[model samples]
Target chain A: MTVGLVIVSHSAAIAGGVVELAGQMASEVTIVAAGGTDDDGIGTSFTRVGAAFESADSGDGVIVLCDLGSAVLTAETAWDFLADDARSRVRIVDAPLVEGAVTAAVAANIGGDLDAVEHAAETAWIRAEESVNSGASEAEPVVPTAIDVVTASTVLVNPSGLHARPAAEFVKLAAKFRAAVTVNGTDAKSLLRIMSLGLSVGTSVHLTAEGEDAAEAIPALVALIDSGFGE
Target chain B: MALGTDWALDWLSRTAATIAVQRSHLNTLDREIGDGDHGENLDRGFTAVLTELASFDDDAVPSDVLKRTAMKLISTVGGASGPLLGTAYLKGAAAIVDLPELDGAALVAMLTAARDGVVLRGKAMVGDATMIDAWTPAVDAAARALAEGQSEAEILDAAATAAEEGALATEPIVARKGRASYLGERAIGHRDPGAQSSALLLREAANAAIA
Candidate 1:
């Protein structure tokens, strides 16, 4: 089971719409929206937030993201009411509701645990920062680690190269393994990093894997890239 | 007369009634510096608390009433006020448990705990142009009243007056906390809605004690 998510917003439509958008990429992940007040006005609700936290959780822990001030306050108050066991599993991530929800959902879809899912949501904006420094891409990828390392070279098959869906698919596969896989030296499991590489069709890149699952990770990743990620 | 459970009930009912009457006034204050929903949101919460009051036992203690009020506000009050006020009431309840009647010391303890709870929940302190500004003044006034050997009613009266003055003082300060802070220097000359509401609630508490 994936780590669940709760999106809190002052507006009902905003929260529900975010849940719908994030759900598109993660059909299996549990995402709940606790937005607006008990009367459906534009304010965060304690009851709705508490209910969302209960339903979204499936024993794998839950991460909560909120839009603004009172939303955060109410969520923290709700957290206090949670049982000790449930409290330990719930974490409040201070990130934008829309982007964070989408990022967290994709990470959860790929079997990322609570901490990884939280990181995915929190660091969703890092890709933009990397893109602005385009002059840095000419540098080499990271040197291979001392662990059991496997390396391969693969050509991009899809005419579109690597975009959202294909890149996400590649990352989902790579992240499932207990290995550190990198494409052209950037992290393969990072959706932002992988997409920021701007790999075009027929551009060959070095794929490397280290750690215990190096052999399995490199071949599976290569096959997925070769298959164009089922595009 | 001692500030007993009956006094607590009266205080809550009076506070709710006052909020219902002054809802628009609070909204106007909020509109100037904040979201303009503070009055309406607090009114809705206290109305729910009034409804929940029926569940209280006839011989309920002060702590029980305060606890239920806290829960009701937490559930009904939307926005930052919900958690802030709810935590205040919750801590207020914890401070005076098992006491059948409240004296000056007990009143001071409750107000101090309530003020601390607001700080703990909202993370706002004095000069931040938040409810804590009024609440802190009221708490310190209450403590001073107790030291001066004032009656329970006098202590509450001192707190109410200081709260009112504290709310008025917010008009010239730029907000550093809450939604009003987003306005930066523009927030000056507008009284913080939270501080105004805190003043109103304390005034009602004092009135109830005398009534």
Candidate 2:
């Protein structure tokens, strides 16, 4: 069972619109919107939140993203009413709703478990925060180490270049193996890092891996890039 | 007289009436530091609870009415007050579940649970210029009255008086929680609508007991 997502917001439009935006990145993942009140007013509803939690969970787990203070309060109150099993699997993440939901949806679509999906959503703002809060390098070079290394290079062929969807797909694949992977000197498993590269149709990126699964991961990603990520 | 369904129902009905009468005042207070929806949201919730008030049976426990009110407010209130007050009722109901009557000690415990629930949900403290500012003092007063072996009505009277002082105390403090916190120093000098409303409810509780 894949992890599901629930987006809670005071505005119904925001919740539904966020689902539509994030759904593009995670087509198969279940992203439910529990926004606004029962009357479609600009406030969170306990009934709406409780129902969303029930429907979003498919026995795996559900990650909740809330906007504003009351949204969190309503979600937490709903959580308190859930059964023990549901309570254990459900989590309310403290992060920006839109970005967190999109990244979480991508992680869920790629079959990441509960913790992985939560991490993806929670870390959604890390890059931006680091840049704003601290002047960190945009190009985070992969840490070089003395380990078994496998390398390959490929050229992108997609018309849209490595955007959010493709970058998410690439990171999804890279994170599956037990190895450190990097593309064009940045961590390959990082969706934001890979997307920030702004690689276009003509750009060539070198794929490198170091660890136990380095031998298999490098060639597989090269094949994925060579395949143009199916456009 | 035992504190039972009559007391609980009377408290809720009186609270609804008080909220309706003071609606504009609450809105005026909220307009200074918040979005000006405090009165509207609270009035809507209590009205919704009143609509379903007649459905309860005579043998129902105090928690029965309280839990029902909690669910109604949680669904109808709409905003931060929804969860904060909703949790107060929910936890308050749970605290006195299955009890046929609430004495001074039981009343103190119930108030404590309600205050704790608000604190847990809103994450606000006594000096935050939120409802907790009013609730904490009321709870503490009830606790002290119970320790002093006061009667149930006297305990509730003490709570009501302390809550009034607490709400008034919020006038000069800057808000440290909720939307009001965004106003920073501008929030000072305005009474917190939530704390004001909380004091009103505590007074209604005392009135119910006296009746």
Candidate 3:
């Protein structure tokens, strides 16, 4: 089993919505919501957060994402109350709730362990910032010509391009091989990084892979890109 | 005089009563710069602490009472103050663990530990227009009074007076932390509700010692 996630928000609707959105990309990943006060008010609840931790962790560790100041404080308080052995398995990550949950879910879907999942959640904001910066100015693609690296390019034919679903599919494919791959200068096995590239229909997709399996990883990724991700 | 479990119970009871009476006032102050829920949240926490105190046996020590209060506040406060003040009580309890009573020196150590806990939890320093603004001054005053060989009650009184002055001094500070920071220059001239509550709580501690 992969790492689990707990969304801690001040509002029940926000936690539930994030869980639903992140769940789409990671159907098998355990994502739970702990939101609102015990009285059904709009505040963080200690009981709810503690209970969510128990439900989310199924042998694999749990990553908690909180929204706003009190949510962070309450989550930390709940973390302190956890049993000593279980406490080590829980991480209260400081990241934006929505984006972090989505990226973390995809990482878990790809079979990432606790550290990998936590990094995915923590670095979600960087990818978001990169996407915003990239959106401001489109850059010309650079072709890699290194002898050891295998590279391929293809135009996306799918209507949605490399959106969430397609990005998830692409990431799952890249993770199957032993090669390290990059798509449009971003990690190919990272769903958020690929999605942050903001590839649209008819846009060119450049893939570069290195390692013993580079030759196989490049063609398979290029072929999957050519397949329009089964759109 | 050395303060014991009876004094601790008195301090908690006075704190609960004072917070209940001052709830609306604190809320009004908080509404000027923050979410306006500090009073309600604190009142709920102290109420929970009072209810939990009913279970304490007669032989319970001062640390037991403080530790129970810390847990109640942490679980029931429902705001940033929950963890901030809860950590204060928790660390204070730890400072004088198993001690049957608190002398002037023990009082200073407990206050210092409590203030340090607030600083650690909130990450706010002096003049940040937070509870630390009051707690730091109060702890400093208590430490000074203890060094001068004051009685335990007198040391608590010095802390209470310094905390009151610290809270009043917050009127001129532009908040640099918490929800109040969002107001920028507009937050100036409004006393921080957290500091004010800290002053009130410390005053209760003094009143209990004097009683």
In TM-score terms, which candidate is top? 2
Chain A TM-score (model 1): 0.81
What number of clashing residue pairs does each candidate have, in the order they appear? 0, 0, 0
Cα distance off (Å), candidate 2, residue B35? 2.5
Over A1-231, each residue of candidate 1 has an lDDT whose tens digit, in order, gives 889999999999999999998887788899999999988999999999999999999999999999988899999999999999999999999776776787899999988899989998989766555567866655466687586999999899898998767777887888888888888888888876776788989999798898998999888888888887666
**Candidate 1 ranges beyond 4 A from true positions:** A125-161, A196-216
For model 3, residues B36-77, the per-residue Cα lDDT tens digits are 988999999999999988788989999999999998898788
Q: Model 2: per-residue lDDT, tens digit, B121-200?
A: 99898899999989999999999988998889999999999999999999899999888999899888999999999999
Candidate 3 chain B has its poorest 10 consecutive residues by lDDT at B74-83
Error of 3 at A170 (Å): 1.5
Off by over 4 Å in 2: A133-135, A138-147, A153-155, B147-150
Docking class of 1: medium
Clashing pairs in 3: none
Tell me the tens digit of each residue's lDDT in model 3 across A207-229.
88877888999888888888877
Off by over 4 Å in 3: A131-140, A147-159, A180-186, A200-211, A222-231
By lDDT, the best candidate is 3
Error of 3 at A80 (Å): 2.4
Clashing pairs in 2: none
